[model samples]
Target chain A: MRITQGAFSFLPDLTDEQISRQVQYCLGKGWAVNIEFTDDPHPRNNFWEMWGLPMFDLRDAAGVMMELNECRKVYGDRYIRMSAFDSSHGWESLRLSFIVNRPKDEPGFRLERHEVDGRNIRYTTTSYAVDRPEGQRYR
Target chain B: MDLDVVPMTGNVNLREELEAVGIEEILTQLDRELIGLKPVKTRIREIASLLLIERIRKRMGLTSEVPTLHMSFTGNPGTGKTTVALRIASILHRLGFVRRGQVVSVTRDELVGQYIGHTAPKTKEILKKAMGGVLFIDEAYYLHRPDNERDYGQEAIEILLQVMESQREDLVVILAGYGDRMEKFFGSNPGFRSRIAHHIDFPDYADDELLAIAELMLGDMNYRFSAAAREAFVRYITLRKAQPLFSNARSIRNALDRMRLRQASRLVADLDRVLSAEDIMSLEASDVLASRVFANGSSPANYG
Candidate 1:
C-alpha cells in the first residue's frame, strides 16, 4: 500500500490541472509555493530536501508548474510534494501540503518489533525504500 | 457575637479591579479554589504561559502557529476535572484564544448514538454547541468499547477526532476519565493521542486536603462543625476513603448534606426551647455519627 501521509491521500491522485488549480489557490492567498522531494517518507520526516527556493515572486501558477516539472524530472520515483508556505503574522509554517508524485512501485515499510520485559513490545517502522542510496531508490 | 454571620467588607482595590483580567487571574483563582493536584495546576500554568507568548508573538509579526489545545484529564470522579476544564475555558478566552469561555460537558451517552446512522449527527451537534468554547467529555473512556463490537462509540470518537483536527482553532476538547482507563483509551487511538497537546493528571486529594474541602463547602453554607464533630468528621472521612464509591469532594458533599439533614431534624426535635444561633448553625458529634450510621449499615456503637 502507498504511504498515505500527506493531505488528500484518501482522495484520488491529483491530475496536472488539479495541481495547477491548487497552486493558483495558494498563490492567490499570497503564499509562496515550494517543491520538496524525499526518498525517506517516514511520518516524522519533516525536513524534505527542497527542489529550490520557494517561488515567492512568481504570482502565476505556470511558474510553479514549471518548477514542479523540473523537480519531477530528477526525482520522478521519489516522493515529491507541493507545499504552500504562509509567512503571515500568525503562521510561518506550511499552510497547505499534498503529495503530487510518488514512486510506481512502493516498497512500503517494515515493522520491526522487539520484545521487552514481560508483555511490553517496542515497535519501529522503517521505509524499505530508504535501504537504497539516493538517485537509485526506485531502481 | 453570631459566629455564623461572617461580615464581608465592601472595600475593593480600584487599581486591581480596573486592571485587565488576564490568564494570571484565572490561574490564581484555580490555585485558590482547587484543594490539591499540584502537578495539574503547574501543567495548566505552563500551557497558559505558552499560549500567552504565542499571542504576543503573533502581534509582533513573529512566527506563531497556534498549538493544539486539546487535552487529556485523567483522574477519578469528583476530583475537579470538570471544574478545571471550565477554568481553562476562561483562561483561553481571556487570552483571546477562544470566543466564549463556556464549557459544554458531556459523557458517552450524549456522544454515542443508539443506531448505526445516529452517532455522527449526535456527536456533530454536540461539537457545534461546544464550538467557540471548550468541550469537556467526562468519562471519555466509555466512548470506545472494544469489548462490544456493535457499539457506536468508535464512530463518535472518529467524528470527534475529525472535528478536533479541523476545528482546532475554534474549539478545545478535554477528555477526562479514570487514569488507567484514559491511558488505555489513548493507547487504542493513536490519532486521539497525537492531538492531545497536554496531559493533566488530577491526583486524588490527600486526607488534609479533603478535610479542607469539606470545611470550605460547609463554610459556604454557613455551617460549622463543633470541636468533637470535627474529630468525628476526620475519622468518618478516613474510614469512608477506603470504601467503594469514595468520590473525593463528592463524597464529602454527600456526607455534609446528610449531616445537615440530621442537624435540621435534631434542631426540630428541640424546637420548644429558645435555641442559640450557634446551636442552629453548628453540627454536633451526634449528628455526624448519625449521618455515618445512615451511610454505612453498621451500628452507632461501631462508630463510637
Candidate 2:
C-alpha cells in the first residue's frame, strides 16, 4: 500500500525494506495512520499486491485496522503511523496514528536466578500484581 | 473384559447439556475473538454467574425473589453490545434461567407499533417473540421521548416498562444505545431508570487492536499481506488517526473487501479469454489502490 497527500494511489511493487523504511519515516515525522487491509469489505485473490495497503474510503477505516494487525504479524519488525480525516461523524477532522509493538526475544532465552537463601528463595503467584524479582515471573 | 461395571450416578450431563443447548459452540465461537473490551467481558461473566446462581436457587425449589434482569449497555456503534447480548441470552438458557433462550431484538419503531390500541398487542407480540429469553432493544433512548407529538415511542416505553416489571423472571430485557443518550433517557424516566441496575460500557478499539482485528479477518480468509502493503495501509491509518470519524472493525472490514475486490477485478480486465487460478490468486499492489476509487474519496489535503 502506497500513501500520497492528494489521492488514493497505490505503489504495489514496494519491498519489505521499503515498507519498513516508510513506516520508520512516518513515525519519525509523528504522523497518524489509518490502517487499510486486503481482507476488509471482502477478501481479495491478489493478496500479494493488496494485502496491507492504505485506501481512501472513509467507510473502510475498520477494514484498514484489521489489515494492519496482519501486517505486524507478517512483517516482524516493521511498523508505521499516519494522520487523516474521518468523514463518518460529519464532525471536525482529527489525526490518528498506528505503531507496531513487537517482542524483544523472537524465540526464547534463558536467565540465571539468584538462590541466595540456599533453601531456594523462589515462590510462584498467579496474580500479575504480585511483587517479585523482575525476571522471576517467567520461570 | 472386567465383569465389574461402574454406574454413573450424577444426574448432571454437563457435556451433553452443553451440546444440546449449543452453549459450548457459542462459547467457542465467542471466545475465539474479543477486541479490546475487558470490562464488558468481566460484566458478561458476572451476569452469567448471576444467571447460574438463579438457576441453582430455582432447582432447589427455594422461594426467593427473582434475580433482576434489567441492564443498561452503553457504548458507541460497532462496540460488541449486540453480540454480547446474544451470548448472554444463550448462557441464560443453558443455565435454565429462561426456557427458550430466544432473543427478540428491536428498535423503537418496532416496539412502539403503530396506532393507539395497536401498541399493546404489538409490544405483546414482540414480548412473545422474546419469551423465555432476552429482549434486546437497540437505541433504546428513542423510547423515552414522549415529547415527540406524533411518535408512539413513549407508548412503547410504557409498554416495555410494564412488560419488564411483569416478566422479570421469564425474560431478560437489555436497553442499549449511545452512552450519553442512554443516560438522558434514563434521567427522563425514573421508572425505567430504577429497573436497570447493571450498566456496562464498551470502549472504542485502539489502532493496534484494530490492526490485530484486520489481521485476524484476513488470515481467516487465507489472505497474506506483503510488507509494503501492510506499511502502506498503516501509513494511511496513521494519517487519519486524529480525525473524529475513526472507522471501527466494521469499517476496516469494508475497506479490506473493496481492496480485494479491486485486486480481483484487475485480473479479469485483460482477459478476453478465461482467467486461470494463478492469475486470479495474485493481487498486485496497484490493483488494490486504484486511483479511480479514491478520486473523489477522502484525502489528507482536503480533510480539514
Task: Give the worst 10-residue stretch by lDDT in candidate 1 chain B.
Answer: B1-10
Candidate 2 structure quality by residue, lDDT tens digits, B218-278: 7877675556666555654555455455546666676677668876677567778686664
The reply for model 1, stretches above 4 Å from the true place, is A1-139, B1-21, B293-304
lDDT of 2: 0.58
Per-residue alpha-carbon lDDT of candidate 1 for residues B1-304, written as tens digits (9 for 90 to 100): 0012123344544344224445677788888988888999999978877875565455454644666899999989889998888889898888767765578899999998888798876776677557667889999989888899779998998888977887676688999999999889889989999999998898999999999999999999999999999998888888887767788899899889989998998888876889889988899999887754436566534322
Which residue window of length 10 is worst by lDDT in model 2 chain B?
A: B1-10
Q: Per-candidate DockQ versus the true complex?
A: 0.01, 0.01
Candidate 2: tens digits of C-alpha lDDT, residues A1-139: 1122222123333444444445434433433334432211111121212233233421212223334555556543322333343334554353443223222322222234556667776532232211334333222
Query: What share of the reference contacts survives in each candidate?
Result: 0.00, 0.00
Chain B in candidate 2 has what TM-score? 0.80
Candidate 1 CAPRI classification by DockQ: incorrect
Give each model's whole-structure lDDT.
0.81, 0.58
